[model samples]
Target: MSERVVPEDSRQRRRPTKQGAVLSEGLIVETALRLIAQHGADALSVRRLGAALGADPTALYRYFRNTDALLLAVADEMIGRAQEGWTPTGDWRTDLRAMGLRIHACYQSNPRAAALAAHRTTGRPHEKRAVERILGILRSAGFPDALAVRIYHAFVDQALAFAAQDAAALALPAAAQEKEAEVWNAVYGKLSADTHPHIAATFPLLAADMRESGYPFALELMLGAVAALRPERRNS
Candidate 1:
């Protein structure tokens, strides 16, 4: 049998969980996400993260200077996850739509993290790769460089903005979530037809349609407008 090699230098500085499991950046991020999901986004703190990991709070500082760094990591991980297995079909419209939906799903998957990091920058490797990939898609569609960049900005910003809004709702407390739903049914759906004829006319369909995601519908509107702008792609 061969002698076992030990990571003495690396292992020396590693932290451990209460159960003796070794701590890692990935585990910390995963635990942090769970804590955010369990508590509210506003409740994320170094102390809470340490507790979740069963390690001293200071231990996290070894990997992250502070909660903001951790948040950045979480945000990058979310984006990385979103980009996984994402192979383009070369059809700009179809591919862009798929990518938008993926981005939306990623944000909603980790609502609290999404809300916190939406306005923040994640200059990590995965984020950079994602940006390059998106720009390539727009370029491949035959959009002029400047115009492609503009559309890229609009497409990304629109997706994230809507995702953030949708995620904020998902992160609301159970009672709050229920309350919002009740408003759709008991409030908006019940408006007086005379006082609000337009809303009243659509009120019947409101509850059902309202329960579904607005991202896809809004995405198509954006794509259609973009197609119109592209003379070559207008028919496409």
Candidate 2:
């Protein structure tokens, strides 16, 4: 019989050797992000993530101590992705608007991941960078340091709060969404025309607002308010 030999790399691949471990911290974080995007934060667990990665569950602990660490890493990754390719335009309103829209779009793109990351303060590098960028925008707009800080706080809180709410809404099953819509429609649709004339008159508009207008509109409104608050430009 002819001698048979297996290629070393092939053997390593088949036997799950740590010699060339395919899984790393970055890969783990990326996988976790995907899981969060696909199955919501509630569905993500070490076992589930390991299964998805085709690696031993304990293998993940080599990179992340626990699910919370993994979640923080995911948050960092989300914020990092949001800031990618962003540049300071020097125009305060334009820059702030761009930053807000980028963050909003990022959350809207991965509602599940956003749901996990939006509210938690990881204080990661990417988040710090985002904060600096926003503060810079306010400063460029001629707001004092205190006012700029306050505006940044409000902007971040509102963005994340709305992102969390939107993610929760999006995570609902279609049937549940329909049911909730129906309940709201029925309850609000039944308001007496005599007693709640305004409600009855604008029911359609209200419902449309509930469905059509979302975080982006709210974000713009917030930015507009901030701009209005900016000290008027002095032409020296």
Candidate 3:
């Protein structure tokens, strides 16, 4: 069989698929996200995407180098969604909190994709813009250059790490998730003070804590630490 070649013009404008649907990078990513959300990340193969978009599977190569490239694009789109319509309030801590929460929520909403792609570094516009905004927030808040970079690095990593962790839990099967959620009450709730004094005493707190995400509390702790490092705060 002769190897098929993509026309250069096809790259310059939106290409119509065999089923007559227009194809663009944005369309591909959006379609991929919806399919993944509905059917899980394993449903994101080029063949499936092509079928969904009514395009040749090879046509996706025009926009992405390979499956990983497409996955990165999807990941970047998640970041872009988290950033949509958000403006920094000029208060560094508040802005960071909002950014962190937005990112976590975006990932949780697409647990399968987030579980698969959260660790990927997509050097795309959305990721780059997020990095730029975070650095700018820290730098403008009186953090020294090196300090700002360090804090920005930690902040981004922390957000991604929590997103991945929470998304992993959410990605589990419904039955498995329900069983896991019950462990705190089923196991820990039975511990007696005579056998495990500390745990028994804190079981109420532990049960509440275990049922929810710890990201918000962790975010606040990080922001409080950063607050103490701000030059103005330190000098004052």
lDDT of each: 0.81, 0.76, 0.87
- The global Cα lDDT (0 to 1) of model 1 is 0.81
Instruction: Pick out the ten consecutive residues of candidate 2 with the lowest summed lDDT.
Output: 10-19
What tens-digit string does per-residue lDDT give for candidate 2 at 170-232?
778889989878865889888989999999999988887888437777888887888778777
**Model 2 stretches with alpha carbons more than 4 Å out:** 1-21, 233-236
TM-score of 1: 0.87
Q: What TM-score would you give candidate 3 relative to the actual structure?
A: 0.92
The full ranking of all candidates by TM-score, starting with the best, is 3, 1, 2
Q: What is the alpha-carbon RMSD of candidate 3 to the true structure? A: 2.8
The order of the candidates by lDDT, greatest first, is 3, 1, 2
Candidate 3 lDDT, tens digit per residue, 1-236? 11344565665437577768778889999999988887887677888998899888877777776777788899999999999989989888889999999999999999988888889999999999999999898887888999999999889899999999999999898999999989988998999999999999999999988889999999999998988888866332
> Residue 234 lDDT in model 2?
32
Candidate 3 or 1, higher TM-score: 3
lDDT of 1 at 86: 93
- TM-score of every model? 0.87, 0.83, 0.92
lDDT of candidate 1 over 73-128, digit per residue (tens): 88888888888889999888988998899999999998887888776669998789
Model 1: worst 10 consecutive residues (lDDT sum)? 1-10
Report the alpha-carbon TM-score of model 2 versus the true structure.
Answer: 0.83
In model 3, which regions exceed 4 Å deviation?
1-15, 18-20, 233-236
